[model samples]
Target chain A: MKRRDFLKNTAVFVAGASVSVSALDFITPKELFAANPQLKWGFLVDTHKCVGCGFCVKACKTENDIPYEANVTRTWVERYVIKKDGDVVMDCPKGARDGYTTKLLDQNHSGMLLVPEDEIAQAFFVPKLCNHCTTPACVQVCPVGATYQTADGVVLVDRSWCIGCGYCIMGCPYGVRFFHPVEHVADKCTFCYHRISKGGDTACAQACPFDARQIGNLKDPNDPVAQTVLSQRVGVLRDEYGTKPNVYYIGLNKEVR
Target chain B: MKNHVWRPLFVVIAIAIGILLFRAFYVPSDFGSQEQGYTFGYHRLSNEQEWKDYPEKYKGNDYCNECHDDKIEELESAHHGTIPCENCHGAAFDHPDDPEKLTIDRSRELCIRCHAKLTMPSSDRNDIPGIDPAKHNQGEECSECHNPHNPSLEDM
Candidate 1:
């Protein structure tokens, strides 16, 4: 080959290398957090603002189009009323999707509804969901590597990867994960990563009628979700299990404890 | 730290690749796809009917009528007119006959499957997005309190 031709080819190669190297910078971990170095993954659920409307549950169902066969609780709200005698009690009168509504409307089963008398001088509803723990047992005990913690710190399952093993269900301290019957896979909340990371919020967070649920990036100390966690003496469910979960509940009731 | 910088780069790069390789291949499949395990779920054997799928199934709405005929009639009258049955039940090719066969994938996991779709609350307008489980069913799991058959909680 001529020297001139060789020189031209060399020039092109150098230029290409420079451009390719710079391109990688565009792919930095935006979905991931490096400031904390722990890759924190979790959520902030404000109970005081929650109205027990069940919007999060419906939003999750409609948004994800959840199949009917998975008889487990993914995301849901619970109603708790403690009697003046300190007898703490709770009820899911509006149990699951199509649960109480269909029956109460049915004349045959309508009589079964047990509308609880207000427990406190005034009573309120509290919602519950998967904790997505820091040291999650579900992540640890998953026989297959179906579930894992993302760089952003959210614990989630890849349905395609999940083998329908219920180990995670047993491992979950919050009793949130369920073995979906139809998909035959393990499923739970991804902290609404689709919306949260992409500059949006979660279904349950937005669905709260009384401004109960709030989502935020822990990295940004100014984030509202994080602020809610700080403002309220919120608690993680089953902290004793040592999952170090990200899902936080504010104004939790005796029923939850 | 001049020409020797590449030496540190080489060591870090090699270690990163090694960790990636181990995570990608050496890890067990059980965490994601358990080759061994056991699972038992809710199913009605006595009501062993097939999941429905009509030839003219525009939306799974027809199956809703066949199963919960009353709810379908009520849903038609409610504000939930444009909503389709499959909106909640993903691709019901075979729901009734063998609900055990394919999964409808409910629970909280369903929320973030789509890219860039947000479910954040407390933003004032909860519309543009979708329904929230709490308010929709009034603290009950939509399925438990309300039956998809008729799509109403009139007392169910």
Candidate 2:
């Protein structure tokens, strides 16, 4: 072969190779990353319908295998009493596992003020759980990257990867994360990922007789829970933090925090 | 080129290639940052499947209906129709096959979880018939008097 022809052929081969290598950068297989845009999970709580029965709390404990004696809970209900004199009192006894039986305060020394029956104006209950934020602070603050958000808008903690740094527990604005009594890792509500992914209702949602708590696929427009969330005037807890929480509330009182 | 320049450049190139090769072998194939504009954080892609496969403890009422259709019918017609069967009788994780009989919770605490009254003036809780535990049938199991299936029927 001639020397000029050999040089020209070599140049063409190198140029083609470089172009192909650079093209590979733009080609990322869709299957490698499994973030399904079609599915998103959301939760709704109707404070008006909630009777503070604590059945949801009991079901959550049983379904999640949380220690019955542990002081921490994945979900709880708080009773708020707004006095006639504009004083607000809030308490969640044993995470509302037992029904609120008495009108009087059980523990006076706990620094909780006892509102007189005549002095009380109105009272209600608000159920609390992990907000499962779109921009979760727990996910951001995990030093070991153990806490993460699922593709379907649920936050989960990899117990094996978690180093018990407690940064996630501190970083959460909703104060939902807690140390698992047995596992000794950061744990919070998963919105019952096992149940929901299998086309079933969450334990808490199913146990709620009054239909106070409901979970649904937010991406599906036909879902009743999705319709209520999309059409109704709902509010979220602590919108100032910019977490973009997925949990929505109806008839949330101004006194609730 | 001088030995100093050429030798150092060769070492730098070799180390860069070595690091890339190590990463290719060390990192998991199904592990990486999430797709851009999707998830808020990075995670093992397979962990999503791990969570989904986790076994559920609270099997719903449909699982109970396979055997206890008679009790389900009576409960469904009663006032406590909305309450699930598993709520009172623990989670049916492995029922009948493993443990034949499910323990029934007949304690007063279980009954009063919804029936015990509170002082909420404007809430829906007032709509539920709540009895003061202190005044009404003190220290007696609630199931002893009222039939749980049909709570409206009094044994007295």
Candidate 3:
């Protein structure tokens, strides 16, 4: 072959190879980049309506296959008794799985006795669970990339991939994350993702007869829970942390943190 | 041109091409961020489906209504209307097909979960009719006198 022709072919091949390197982006499926902007899951808790029945806790444990005997729970209720003297007493015995039939005498283990009924100015139950924050601390702290927030705004932990480093657990401000006794991995609420994705209410929401707990798509204007969240004055737990939690409480009191 | 300059360049280009090819083969097609803004750029896209497929143990009243419409209808009209059927009877997971019948929870503890008197004056729990277990029918099962399907209704 002539030297000139050989030089031209080599130049074209090198340029073509460089151009093909940039085409690597095309290998990734287009669907992975297509974000569904319409759906964003949110939860609402009406503290005034929660009766401390503990049914939601039971349902969550059963639906998620969390060990019944294990003290760890994905969701729980806290009973707060505020004295007229401004001392706030809080306790969540057995994660409120069994009702608050027997009150905890030493809730903080500070050797403080239970305030008598007459000294109490107000008492209420606050159901607590994973906030499924917009900017989740757990997701940010996961070193192994096991925990992530889904497109629909639910934070999920890939149990198989979790290293159980407990960073995510410590990073959480609400103390929602726990190591599964059997799995020995960092675990928390999925917002009952298995049920909610299939057009079913969460196990906790469905078990709540009083309609105190609800899960809904915040993007959907028609959802009653969404309406309540948007139209009414709702508050989230530990807003100062800047996690931007999704769970909204209707009758949240000042005493609650 | 020096052989060293072109030789290293050629080798670097070949290695780059090799790495790209390996990535295409190794990385899953559905492994990446699902959205554009404010998203952590690492996650398995297929894990969403894996979570969605996780079996739900507590099938709500709608599942039971397929067969036990009569019981559902009766409960809906009564005081226990809001309570799920599975709440009292264990989670209707693979019901009738596997267990044939649900184990009815007729324990007094089950009944008292909502009815047990809490002395807190500022709470809404006082709205529900509560009784001290020691004072109310003690030791005897609540189902003996009250029909759990309709708690207000007296059992014959």
Best of the candidates, DockQ: 2
- Candidate 2 backbone collisions, by pair: none
Q: lDDT tens string, model 1, B56-148?
A: 111245556777687668777654443444544554545566453444545432321111122223221223334533345444444554444
Q: Using TM-score as the measure, name the better of candidate 1 and candidate 3.
A: 3
DockQ score of the complex predicted as candidate 2: 0.41
DockQ of each: 0.03, 0.41, 0.35
DockQ of 3: 0.35
Query: What lDDT does the true structure give each of the candidates?
Result: 0.53, 0.84, 0.85
In angstroms and one decimal each, the interface RMSD of every candidate reads: 15.4, 3.0, 3.1
Model 2 chain A: lowest-lDDT 10 consecutive positions = A25-34
True contacts kept of each: 0.00, 0.69, 0.58
Docking band of candidate 2:
acceptable
Candidate of highest lDDT: 3
lDDT of 1 by residue, A1-257 (tens): 99999999999999999889877554443312332453344577666555444556766665554663444556776555445567644455433343212111112334433323443433444567777665567777866555766545566665655677689888777777876756777777766665555455565565443456666666566777677676768777767777776777766544565
Q: Candidate 2 chain B: worst 10 consecutive residues by lDDT? A: B32-41
Work out the iRMS of candidate 2: 3.0
Give residue A179's error in model 1 in angstroms. 1.1
